[model samples]
Target: MTRSLLDPSAVPAELRPYLAELVQRVGILCGPHLLSVFAVGSIALGDYRHGRSDIDVNVVVEPSLPGEVVRELAESLADGALRCPAAGLELVVYDSAFVGRPSDQAGYLLDLNTGPLLPERVSFDPAAAPAFWYVLDRSIAYQSERVLYGRPVRHVLAAPSQRHLLAALMASVREHTTGIGHLPDNQVLNGCRSVAFCRTGRWAAKREAAQIISESEPDFRPLLETAVRSFERPRTAALELPATEVRTFLAWVRERVEEAAESRL
Candidate 1:
């Protein structure tokens, strides 16, 4: 078991204290059963915006916990859900069995945002969901730059293979863009980042990917710039992009991802 806490200064100004207290409370709640806890997504990436982005966290715990205990924990977590300064919070609890064993399927005990105990429950299939997505997250954890608590990320997560990383990228893009016509800034930026990862094995934030696309694929600069702007400054007023253009761009990104997958094979 490993435990190294991060300085509160790493998180956004408005969210640091809240996250610190939340992590502390959760740690205390789990106590002896707690294995590790850390963050991911925009917040971990340091690009999270107050009103636009979400805080993503993963808590690993002892596998012996009863389902009822998990439910109780979920309910407790909900009491502070709205306290998140970002758009919302997304937190999942996984068993400690995955510490070193890497697999394409990860079994999670609970997802706070879409669990049975939450009011905003959504459909989720843990079995069919590809675990390859954890590859990027594992990579982030190994870096130790974003870990919030528990064992050092490298000790807790297995290093993901290139094939797994690319597979996860494709899967995420398909899930987010399929049948979706209008693209938001995050979607657009994520699509570009997927393309960048597929071409070069290097993973990057959306902003970095936008810069890469601007330098390499100048034709897409206008769209990428617009996406960056939208992501940086989210408007409270209902804002929608041209559906036709979004659809076309999404199709192009999908095609690129497919081509990248094929090239790998």
Candidate 2:
């Protein structure tokens, strides 16, 4: 069986030491041959937002690690969860032996190491953006960008359902999120959640602006911010209008898309 130890590069920088220890123990306990580790969630994607409850990690092991070893490690790490108050900890361990079983049946990535684990498959989209979105209010204390064990994780840069997805994400926010769908949005609200979503969408817009400006034209941060706010303005308006104006909603979406198309030009 493949006992390739966890690749440290695949892990994130913030959880380096703990993962490193995990690697050491894994190697010590499981002999070595065909096992590997991978980072699979927000922390790896580089867009982890603030106020995340806990960091999620996927530890890929080979079929070689004994079931007992996997069980033992899981119990130990579960105890580690108590150390951090803000974020809960979970590890879904996987390798070749455990892939065929039900997907839901497998516990956290770390736990899979116990017996017949399978390598979790990951796929990435080329055009998707991983702009930083606020999880709670800019308090991502545990998820760091630095790569600790394996390759970086990612989110799709482009969306096939950009509008629909945006629509769904903002659905519950109509009443809850003040500035989001409000056209000609309140600049104050546009800048930050203020008392609303706290540091959510605006933070994403801010990060998106920074990245775009830095890459396309470092001086364009402000311009980019304005552009994002422009999108938010129209979107916010369309999202809130009366249901009788279904046609108007579609028209607005067409306008939003057209506007997006033009801005790229």
Candidate 3:
């Protein structure tokens, strides 16, 4: 029998039921091969917003688990079937081998996206995913994941090296600068979080990082403030930040990240 490590009380009250169902379904689908299920992102960081945040879950399974089981698991937990109560469910499944020796690049067996705010996606190919995001997310998970079942996070999740993290941060900055139709709030907050991680080598929640940055960089406070406010609003109610200001903020962040990366060499 797998040792259960879930603490229902640690989860937000409203999300508890959904999480319970999710864990139960996943256990049923993956059977004895399921190693662990845990929460990351906003929920793990204590910054979850009932109507605005997605539940980001990471699951680990034995290497021998069949691909068909993985596909069935994804289909069962998809938006229509599981009916995500939050913005959506962003779940990634990894075999124990990958978890034991995680790559700096993408190594997920499945990347499942579901929810009203997110475009539904079920990706099985690592090459199809952006590697930087996975690296950064794993870094964050190492620092603050909440295990819902199976073994402790530290036993299964490796902390990404500062070099890999900085690389990932730089890649994210490049994406923001060149990407089209980006979410303005995400742009600003991501910059704030990246700068925080670069300087402190610690992961802070999006708004927490923004608040810390706002004090030291008063010039960007208004932009950060606007982004935080917009981020807290329901998706339908959020307002867009000015494009020029967002570009400027991102440029500043790019400089900081580049400086941080250079200083280490």
**In terms of lDDT, which candidate is strongest?**
3
Predict model 1's lDDT versus the native.
0.67
- For model 2, what is the alpha-carbon lDDT of residue 73? 57
Better of 1 and 2 by TM-score: 1
Which model is ahead, 1 or 3, in terms of TM-score?
A: 3
lDDT of 3 by residue, 37-113 (tens): 88888888888988888899999899999999989988999988989999889999988888776567789999999
Candidate 3 lDDT score at position 109: 92
Tens-digit per-residue lDDT, 103-169, candidate 2: 2122222432121112222212212312122112111211232323333312101111333323332
As a TM-score, model 1 comes out at 0.84
Query: Candidate 1 on 72-114: residue-level lDDT in tens?
Result: 6666666454355555666777777765666555556776663
* TM-scores, all models, native as reference: 0.84, 0.37, 0.95
lDDT of 2: 0.36
C-alpha RMSD in Å of predicted model 1 compared with the true structure: 3.7
> Sort by TM-score, best first: what order?
3, 1, 2
Evaluate all candidate structures by whole-model CA lDDT and list the values in order. 0.67, 0.36, 0.87
Top candidate when judged by TM-score against the true structure: 3
What range of 10 consecutive residues in model 1 has the weakest lDDT sum? 114-123
Q: How should the candidates be ordered by lDDT, best one leading?
A: 3, 1, 2
